[model samples]
Target: MSEKIRSQFGCSKMMLPEHCSMLREQALAEYRAENNRFPETDEQLREEQQYILDEARAGGKTVIIKTLNSNGCNHYMGIPLRCDSTGNKIIIRTETGPDLSISAAEVVSLTIAD
Candidate 1:
């Protein structure tokens, strides 16, 4: 007998672990509303984040940092303020009007408001 063919399929690369287009759409809409536009779908936000990170460490640059929340449940975006050598950790002032320090290594998602 021939081997059975697979019926169900699965996705490989994804923006989120689980499919959450609704949540993603909501977030995108909010971003558009805030910046009057949307970020490029090239998924290059991480690069943008890195560029901003470098600028921040060098001093004086506005950046949006997507960092893991303290609750270990969700992510948040903020503008970096200061940093130490190698940019392992940075102090960022969030759009919500507060300062926070997030680890660069732990942060994989981020965006530049450009």
Candidate 2:
């Protein structure tokens, strides 16, 4: 007589636990690389980003800022308040939350909010 197939465990092929976890990690890394691109690397790009920030500050326009850090990238939208003399840090007044203070070095990109 032929052996019966198990109901709980399907008859399909199985992968090792370690291999499955490794594949998951690889997929996550690829996604992060594509989505979380490194901010401006060259001097010219950095200057352009700074220009956008300055314009937003001057015109009192709401700006969307993307910052990158060790943890990950963060997105903030608000009106610029002020920056230190050296422009090392920036302050933004948010609508729903308390003022957010961000480090200039972490800023990746900026855009005027609609």
Candidate 3:
């Protein structure tokens, strides 16, 4: 059977994974709301996220983010941030400083990393 046919048959037999489906839907919704297009893959999501991050950084905005490191002692001086493609979430480096670190659940409020 063709790959498309196999996917269709297999999809009917199992539920879509929640994370994948949610990311797909979010991508579609954002596309529709902005450019009336749909993201076809996770790579597209990464591209979008990078674009936004670059734009913000270029504009010299101070971004808020959730730290991936659970321990708050790691140095983030030279590492780049990571972002979720479909969601408005970014990972930042947190060190022993007075800067505020958000939780992953509160990532929507991130602005730009300073």
Candidate 4:
């Protein structure tokens, strides 16, 4: 098997450590067979993104999001409180230490840093 395929299936020698190569290959093949698809529309894309976000929230990870100004400077940083689909932005409780709330129109990026 190719190195790329091996790595994708977590079948690398480093990952296996104790498991046999054949066992790793079987596990990887099962995983690949279970999940294989390409989103065909914007709605599908949004669903996938929401699934990821939901998983992150359920995992108890701190979701930090940053909002940038027109000049590309970071204008806000905080823990995302919730996403408002109608408003198309996230409601964040600012980390600036005084219980401030803000609506971030554009999320530059999200980090699930534990």
Candidate 5:
């Protein structure tokens, strides 16, 4: 029922709810690959983020934080360095290059793996 409504909307730019809904699926796949399980709730996602932040502060962990691309799509990989004061930006160490600073609004998910 709801699945039909969701797939019907897809990622059309005009349908914000559909975009938001699909983001969950993206986050789920990332979470599963990183943790070997799917998050059961919003709290689980938050806990995962906190765990990544703590691990990042501790250093030497591979972290993948999803930030929206220029086209407003999400999928990225990097090491979390830290977030700036406004909470709207973060610095990340990229897989093949230098650090990158991206907007907090652009970040849709977090995945930390060994």
Candidate 6:
């Protein structure tokens, strides 16, 4: 037995203006949240940041590196293969792809994965 009143409204061709506006606002909010909209600091806090990275690399522990990029905040989880201060980058061995070399300038935070 099918109920005629229970029509599927998924992906309707038409949408109200209010609905469109609401969706636009929601998308903008999500973009800001994902990008870490906080003001960027001029100081990189290199010494403190490097200390955390060194600890993780020396212990051979998996770490989560949160980086801020033009697209947004990207998260990389893996064991660090190398930390090159002179080159201003760190290479990480991820399970799904080739080792990633992330610039120190883009790094927002680094934490050991539990």
lDDT per model vs. reference: 0.60, 0.83, 0.47, 0.54, 0.68, 0.81
lDDT winner: 2
Q: Worst lDDT window (10 residues) for model 2?
A: 1-10
Q: Which is the winner by TM-score between candidate 5 and candidate 6?
A: 6
List candidate 4 stretches off by more than 4 Å.
Answer: 1-52, 75-78, 94-105
Could you tell which candidate, 1 or 4, scores higher by lDDT? 1
Higher-ranked by TM-score: 2 or 4: 2
- What would the per-residue lDDT of candidate 6 be over residues 3-113, giving only the tens digit for each residue? 434545543448899998999999999987866664454445667667777888899888898888777778999989898879988999987889999987888788889
TM-score of each: 0.40, 0.63, 0.26, 0.39, 0.49, 0.60
Give the Å error, residue 3, model 3.
50
Look at candidate 5 and tell me the lDDT of residue 89: 75
Best by TM-score: 2
Considering lDDT, which of the candidate structures 1 and 3 is the better prediction for this target? Answer: 1
Q: Kindly list the per-residue Cα lDDT of model 5 for residues 10-97, writing each as its tens digit.
A: 5344757789789998998887566543234366666667677678757867777665544545565777788785766767788898
* Model 4 residue 89 CA deviation in Å: 1.7
Q: Given candidate 2, what's the lDDT at residue 56?
A: 86
lDDT per residue for candidate 4 within 1-114, as digits (tens), equals 787776865553364445677788899988765553222335554565456556665664456554444334345444555677776765555555643344334444456655
2 or 4: which has the higher lDDT? Answer: 2
Candidate 5 displacement at residue 74 in angstroms = 3.2
Scanning candidate 6 in windows of ten residues, the lowest lDDT window is 1-10
Off by over 4 Å in 5: 1-47
Higher-TM-score candidate of 1 and 5:
5
How many steric overlaps does candidate 2 have? 0
Model 6 clash pairs are none
lDDT of 2 by residue, 1-114 (tens): 223355434446598999989999999999988777665567887788778778988999999988898689899999898876486888998989999999888887878898
User: Using alpha carbons, what is the TM-score of model 3?
Assistant: 0.26
Per-residue lDDT over 18-110 for candidate 3, one digit per residue giving the tens place of the 0 to 100 score: 977998999998875665322233555446546665765556454443333323322223122555545644444444444333333332222
RMSD of each: 14.1, 6.4, 15.5, 15.2, 13.2, 8.3
